[model samples]
Target chain A: MIRAVLALARSDLFRWHRSPALVAATLIPALSMGVMVVALTYAVGRQPVALVIEDHGPVADHIIQIIRESDGFFLVERTREEALADMKAQRVAAVITIPAGFEDRVGSHDAKLDVFINNVDLDFSDDVRRSINEAVVEVDAPSLATLGENDLPPGTVSGIPNPYRIDVAERDLRTPDVSFLAYQMVPVLALLSLTAGALVTALAIAGEREVGALRLVRLSPVPRTAVVAGRLLGGTVASGALLSAVVLAATLTDVLSPPAGRWPLLMLLLLVTAVGSVGLGVLVGLLTRRVTTTAMLGVNVATASFLLGGGFTTIAFLPDFVQGVARAFPTYYAVEGVREVLFYDSMPTLGRNLAALTATAVVSLVVGSVALARVSARPH
Target chain B: MSSWWRAFDGGLRTQLRSFLRTPMTAFLVLILPINLLLLLSLFALTGYNAPTALVMGEDTAAARSYVEALEDTHNSFELRPMDLATAQDQLKRARLVAILEIPPGFEAGVQAGHTVPVNLTLDNVNLDMAEDVRRAVPAAAVIFAARNAFPEVRIEADLRNLLPRDTGYVQYLGVSAVALAACIAGAVLGGTVTAREWELGTARLSQLAPGGAAAVLAGRLAAAAVAGVVASSVTALIVWFGYSVHPVHPLEVGLTLVATVFACTMLGGLVGAGLRRVMPVAPLLIGTLLPFYLDSGALEPQRFDGEWLFALAHLSPTYYSVGVMEHAYHGLVVTPEPRWLLLLALVAIGLASLAALPRVARR
Candidate 1:
């Protein structure tokens, strides 16, 4: 049985090597995802934003000086027309225009300040708006007591003086920034492992039917269970190895933390997932009975799994019902397990997630095996 | 001309029947778009809840006074008597945008009429919410004082900046319909029918027919093109009837639909014939569709900035589809310029390549 499994796994690897199209199909998503992770991380980490000032007056200069004094913003432009053009082109994030006599009006306390920002950016637009508000917050307010003190005498302040002031307080309860790559890796690796497992199984089963090798396998002295088990074992090894390589590469590159404390348990959980996925592939292959259909079904399954697992967006933002539907999907557990290892830096929750993943894998494998056995037993 | 008409009719009938035959395929074609629209509608509904604010305080009367004042206002606040650790956790969960803290003044500043410093701690990561909180706090502070002063001093300033600007519902729905165009075209043009013919060794059947393979391929192309148009239009009408959003210009809509059908039909033919399998075709289609949907300016494009990202988005047929659809929904004139012509040319090239696939056939 071991020899049979080894032979099947070797043959599958050889097929993967020879088929450029299959290799390309599998690698395309991985490459794109890698690129996106890098691009977004870079964008978030260091965004170059210029504040273009249109006013040439001292007030404008003071405002620009204030902005320059602040840490996040860069005063990159001067002149309103140039700023507006740059803003439309997205070269500059915000433009602050101080209308003429702005300081004079503020001195008299009669004029209001107006600010404009291109709302295309939810992040940067809000940043500029806040900076402006903070500037206003820092400005000293002229009270009636101060006015009275200036108008009458310093000791002449009388009547029930206002005895109230607002006290603002804030608290932040947040997890540290988890690497977007690590966050994304959970779903990516799960999808990759499941897809590879399902594809290899489907291809092996469908290829036998297409090339008339199934009859040969059936006629051999080998028991049907041995043949099925060997094929599933081969698929399980291939998928488990594929995911292991990705996790290892990520660890070496510092994209993922090395598995710790319970590496063997993680491996066992991954193997279970692989076996279940193989069974699923075999069931789909048997039902479809066509290589093309098997491939299409495989792609559909992979894409739907990724979407349902909340790969591209946070699950918290999705509707409550969608979140419920997502929890029922197998990829959800796989993703959770991966995230536990990569982000939370914990082993216990990893065990729980892996246990759930193993349960799902076992259930799928049983249903798949039964379906495949029934289909194969039917007389041609 | 005669062959083209025959091709169109046969293609329409064959495509429709094929779509109806496979319920999953039909679901892929019809339901995915509706599902996305429904999802967007769901976002439009529950998304209107007032923005969330975070209020923090120590166990003091000043803290009590601040919380009461905030609660008296119209905004929603997640009030918590927390230490620094819990405050940090609340920020990560995004349950609180800004934290308001009152120091141990013991009511002395109010009695002395001194300007008391009220410190506001905000998650600088979310700049918008910080801005909103900054604006609301001062106003709420003023209003709270006014409630004790003359009741007539309760002049609420209509804060327009606190809310997002209106980018009409029709414009939003238009983007989804255009995105669905790519997926629908992919299913109709690239899926089982073309792949099955290739796999069954029956592509040779068409290749050996009259006018050689090109004529048969042209017929399929013509059919696929017509099928793409009808499918896109039906989905467009759903947006119109279900959402009561009309295209800005009927002519622009017609031209845009025609261009999109051509582009998708050609993409389907080329990808289907080149891959010669439904599985590869589906992934390729989905892989291409994903990024296009994300960057279509439907929700947020300003989040990420890269010339290459924008360049890739420019190549997507959905981008042009969205542009023309937006223009149509706004009652603007849709002109078929050089860019449109170029897209049409690409579609033609795709059809020719698919027609020539017999030469590229493996074994």
Candidate 2:
């Protein structure tokens, strides 16, 4: 039985080595994930803005200076007409216009700043609006007072009094801050593992069936269980190796931390995820029995898992209904488990995650084993 | 000329029949676009809701007023009144996004015109959500201060939106989704169909035909372009009816999709002729689609991202398609010269088609 399993595993390995397209398909998602992480870092924060200062007064200059100092705005000075044109072309997110007014308006404390924003994306537009509000606060900071400074005369002090202060003392409960790229890369790594294991197994099985090789195996005296076990073992090893390489690269590149004492937990989670994906892939192959259909199914399943299982976006950000659906996918547990170990330095939900993954792996393997046995028992 | 026309018609019919026979082709060309639209729309509808806990240490009027102020603001946080211990527990469990605590003597300090600090504990596990909380807290404080200050001094900042209306993230993505549908149908489905002939050893049939390979290839290209248009149109209709994004100029939307389909179809034909295999076509097209989708002002204007990405956007058909679609849907002029861009895209399509015709005609 062991010899039969080893022979089957070696054949599958040789097949994988010959099929460059299949190998490339398995690795494409991981490559794309890397690019996504880099792109996302560049995409967030620090939007471009056009500054059209119609007023040459000190107050206008001060506001412009404040806008420049804020990290949120990357300012480009333009004339009013030019700013309008640039905004129409989407070269800038918004146009900050200082209306024609003398510095005398500041003495009256009724100075107003006009802002024209292209509110296409609420998130980025909100950032622009918030920055503008902060600038307003800074401009008006001189007239404000601290908690107990109201009794002092306003003009007696050289500086401004900040009367109402709302201090935000942030206490983050997690470990050191994870970069956006690192945070998003965690799920991408898991997604790569899932896709590679499932698709490779499914394609290998379906391709064998298509080429009449599985029928030849069935006619032989080898036990059907050995063949199935060998296939699963081969897939798990291949996918596990790929996933480990990805994790190693991420850690070496400083995209993720290799938490000491947690490598065992991480490896266990990865192994279970691979086994579960391979089992699921064998089931898909048994059902489809065609390479093209199985490949399409694999792609669709991988995409659904990636999108709905918190691969690109956080599960907490999803709606309640979607979150419920996400919980049903094994990728969700794997992602959450990996993130908890790598980022938070704690294994709070390891038991639950492990139980879910193990349940998935056992159920899929049982069903797949039975189905493959039945198919092998059929007359060719 | 008559014989060539007859051959083209025959080839078109044959291509359509073959496409209908293949279940995968039908699914990719027809069903995938609708599925993507619905999924992307669902993603758009799932707005960000921050889970927050309000820890009131002192039941003072100012503290009560502050809590009320937070509740009244048009914020994304789902604030609930909880004790400190419960808040801490929830935060540790990742159930809560942030906790806002009003300490004791908060009302006295504020009533005496003192800068009383509001303790805000944030789970910065997700920095995007944390940033939202940071921005919202200060805005809420300003609102509370404005309401309670003795001398009412308000800053009058006149804000004007340049766009006709606010476009939601989903709505923006929906427009891009239409373009994306066009690309997938034209490239993946069309490329697969065209390449399958070579893979299945049927290219000789076209090479031996009376009308030559150009006529047969034209028919296939036409069928693929039509399928691309139909798929993209269905996606547009879904976006219109389902997402409430009505295009101001429906004709422009149609024209943009048709042009995109033609351009992408030719590009796919080039790929099909070059690769001569169906298995690699899907992955290649889909893999390339993502970077194009991301860089082509799908999420936001490409130019605003940075100069490099903005320059890179010019190389993708999606960028021009998105430009025209944005103009049609939201009346936003995202590109400086959209017509020129479209013309350039058409020129590229013509060049690619010319380049691919010889390859498809080869024995």
Each model's TM-score, in the order given?
0.73, 0.89
User: How good is the docking of model 2, as DockQ?
Assistant: 0.42
Model 1 over residues A231-320: C-alpha lDDT tens digits? 777677777777888878877887666346646655665566666677777877776676655655666566566656646444444557
Interface RMSD of each: 9.5, 5.0
Question: What TM-score does candidate 1 reach?
Answer: 0.73
Interface C-alpha RMSD, model 2 = 5.0
- Give the DockQ-based CAPRI class for model 1: incorrect
Expressed between 0 and 1, the share of native interface contacts present in candidate 2 is 0.41
Q: Which lDDT tens digits does candidate 2 get at residues A1-380?
A: 99989888787777777888778667765666567567867776567999888887666787788777765688999999999888877789999888787355666655677889988776577667756765666555532212111243312322333533554445556545567788778778777878778888888888778777778776778888998888888888888889888888877989877568888888888889999999998898887776656756666676667766665566765668878988988998888888788766456787898899999999999998888878777766
DockQ, per-model, please?
0.20, 0.42
